[model samples]
Target: MSSFKREFTKLYNDSPANYIKAKRLEKAAELLQASDNRITDIALDCGFNDLANFTKSFRDKYNVTPSNYRLKSR
Candidate 1:
């Protein structure tokens, strides 16, 4: 593995929770790329059943709503 992969492996291994959190956030971001989907739909698609929890997590990670992130990315 390269330095980047080794560093990430160490960090991810240090905190399994962070690895899962990152995966969920990544999936949510991908779903948010779809302009047609509502935030609730994206949240569910990202394995988050609670829209409120998803919104909170998304905001904490990106400092904005999923809709806002999509709009700005566009």
Candidate 2:
């Protein structure tokens, strides 16, 4: 596994919910920087099971939707 993947997995195992949120946001950040993948695709790839839950968690953590976060960065 990659160093990042291992570190993230460790973080995930140490605190599932916290790491879930963190990993999602990290991948969301990467997607924002790297690609134009849709929010739903990024959410699923980042381990979110549902768009609604992803949106809610993202909003709770970042205070914005994934799209809006990306836009703000741009």
Query: Which prediction has the highest lDDT against the true structure?
Result: 1
> Which ranges of candidate 1 are over 4 A from the true structure?
1-14
lDDT, candidate 2, 25-60, per-residue tens: 788778866888888898888888899988888888
Q: What is the lDDT of residue 59 in candidate 1?
A: 91
Among these predictions, the greatest TM-score belongs to 1
Worst 10 residues of 2 by lDDT: 11-20
Model 2 alpha-carbon miss at residue 23, Å: 1.8
* Model 1, position 28: C-alpha lDDT score: 83
- Clashes in each model (backbone N, CA, C under 3 Å)? 0, 0
TM-score of each: 0.73, 0.70
Give the Å error, residue 16, model 1. 1.6
**Model 1, residue 71: C-alpha shift (Å):** 1.1
- Candidate 2 residue runs with Cα over 4 Å from true position: 1-14
